[model samples]
Target: MAEFDVVVLGGGPAGVHAALAAASAGLNVALFDENASAGGQVYRAPLEGMRAASNADQQAGDVLRRELTASTVTTFFAHSVWAVTGDYRIDATGPNGPVHCTARALIVASGTTERVVPFEGWTTPGVIGLAAATILLKSQGVLPGRSTLVAGCGPLLAAVAAKTLEGGGKVEAIADLAGTADWARTLPAMLARPGLLRQGVDWWRTINRARTPRYGRHTIIRVEPADERLRATLAPCDAAGRPISGQRTTVLADCIAVGHGLTPATEITRLLRAKHRYSRAAGGWIAVADQDGRTSRPLLYVAGDGAGIAGAAAAATHGALAGLACALDLGAANPVRLTRGIGPARSAHRHAARFGHAMANLIALRPGHVESITPETIVCRCEDVTRAEIEAACDAGARDINQLKAWTRCGMGPCQGRTCGDVAGELLMRRMGTASRETVGSFSARTPLRPVTVEALTGNFTYDEIPIPKAAPL
Candidate 1:
């Protein structure tokens, strides 16, 4: 068993900042991440020789990396935390044999996951989420294809398109759902943050330069595959996400990127029984945390996008604040100095959060977002379960989320049902009479959550044949 004063459960921006700040305050800290590296999805390493060409993204990432590496915090990459018992117990699997670690205080910054809205033919091999496509490019420096259609409902779609083109992929077009009407409603909020508005303009200018068509009020209705590639049908939609007339068009591409948006990464915190609130504007249910980032649990705290759908700047700021809070709770710091030093970070967080709210509202999922899904669609890719199977589970008296999962195995697959949990719940709720909150339970996360190479798990193998105690003694 290993012990620490603080143990952070993720290596993303929030977790990194939390670990570093806590350590700087004179606490022994360890950061555990399930990935092979620290950057998580946003700061993912760009392909071999290609770095993140964007000046803003790169600078932000560099500062974070520096702060983390400079601190006394020890980081454990490729280690998965399976379960947590009480306020301190964490069962993690790593190079060590099912290592058990206990910390006086725990910080959860697991971040968010992609929110996929299923549609007909969505499970076709060529269809992927905006974040998943970004992961592929950032991790391997490879594009899904030469010609790609970026169709999604958030700023991430724009960022992904830019990154795709930068990596030598040809972007066919970008069909965005943020129409002028929606922007008009969002204008007041956008004007509140001039700096963020400027950032938005810069991204638009880059998109314009690439000649990528940015359509507003549009939705993808159908995606057909030809010769093992994808062809998508798009049309204009009103604010309610309904199809408008006379705007139907078909686009040809090898791959399509689509997503509703993101939800807070709250699995670890949910296990701790932290309170959660459903804010459609905040991308869905998120942990209900206090201003200082403290959760309901005395020794447990949460920050960043995991607590809510905030951006990188907001995440870093909250992370720093939480780290300070953790330090104070552990009796490791002088009250006055910690309080004074936290002001600037707090200001940054407020500024970033204001813009984050605006962005979140602007990209809220449309009312009829699930219109594209058909009965034959595969909602849970890991389990190969179709929409029909989910409905059957609901019809068979699996009224609650857990019951549905138990009956149909909707979320009982290898991906831990992350891919299908929400959608399955939504379907289950529609079929049954349960409330949405009651129908959607947390995804099951086990140790070694991500698949690692067999060699990595067996590399330390040593065969020592222990001889049976000789019966000669008997």
Candidate 2:
């Protein structure tokens, strides 16, 4: 296997920054990203022959990509890391073929995935996640539909609405689960970072200019097919997100884009056996890491949304700190030189983290929302497992998420619970009367963390090279 001083997983803001920092310190760094490009989801680059609507972010990503290319770091784009062993060996499938590499130090910056809670008619053809819609617009320069209803619990709802308008898609309405009071409560924290506040204002201005109907403290109660369109029932929700009895509104649109913020992408970290803690504000279970991104596992670190959902700025800062720390540990750079950059990065991360916390509070998912799930609503779209099925399993004494999985096969699918784990855990927790989500626990990470083709796995090796060990003496 090829070896490196450091290997960084992911190509998002954090991964790129970490690779750059470590390489600049004269460490042989190898960075592997699943995407064809370096920018993570937040700063995803537009596809070839397409231009992104947000020039600033695109330009910023471009600058980082340029710097990464110029650095000594070896980049492997379009590479999916499937398994990472305890010995720091990584097995991945790249554009060419299988890649096996080992590193003395490892950094995981795998980023975040959308947190989707299912509702009635969510499986309908027109429904999509907010992140999916954003990717469609930003990367491919395509709208989800001609007319769309955007509903969610976070700032992404507003941002997607703005992007939809900018991309020439008609936004029927924008519904936010957080009320005006929620925004007011987060004012002080929001003010701590003027740039983030300005970005929010900018999205607001776009929606305002388009005169889109805006609903606060509202959520989609149900949706039904209406000819070629979808009819979504909206209801005013209480602080806990339980729908109010008397208030209801209906929206007609070609499509619905919805999500409840993001959760840390923790499969890799979990597989590595890092300590984790549940933080609702930090976007579910996250790796326990210091400000410098050093995890409980020695010589292993996690940064970006994989550590917590602290947005792009904080992710970059955290990545820098992790890289510097790695450099210090590897003796590639002196303590004074490496330590100098960490203080400012740590401060920036603190400010960004505060903003992230405020935003998380404003858009927090409540237990009431979980209570609202109908028996028929599909909880695990990958496996077609319904709420009723999960409840039945729980009633049958499936105490933990793993038990639920074995009983109902809820999380056994291609997505591997990336889309349904949180909601499923919530359901199991409520049924089992579990005091905390941590008690329910997350799905166990297994080999081939992501889907891989059989051909890719076996085509690279001959039968003799399969490494079948001889039987031990009885």
**What lDDT score is found at residue 321 in candidate 2?**
85
> How does each model score on lDDT?
0.77, 0.88
| Model 2 per-residue lDDT tens digits across residues 36-59 | 898888788989877556566788
Write the residue-wise lDDT of candidate 1 on 176-280 in tens digits: 777877667767767876766686777677778888877787888788887766889898877766677866878889999888778777777776777777667
lDDT, residue 471, model 2:
100
For TM-score, the strongest prediction is 2
Task: Spell out the clash pairs found in candidate 2.
Answer: none
Output the number of the lDDT-best candidate: 2
Model 1 stretches astray by more than 4 angstroms: 47-54, 93-99, 188-196, 244-247, 342-344, 433-459, 462-474
TM-score of 2: 0.95
List candidate 2 segments past 4 Å from native. 459-474
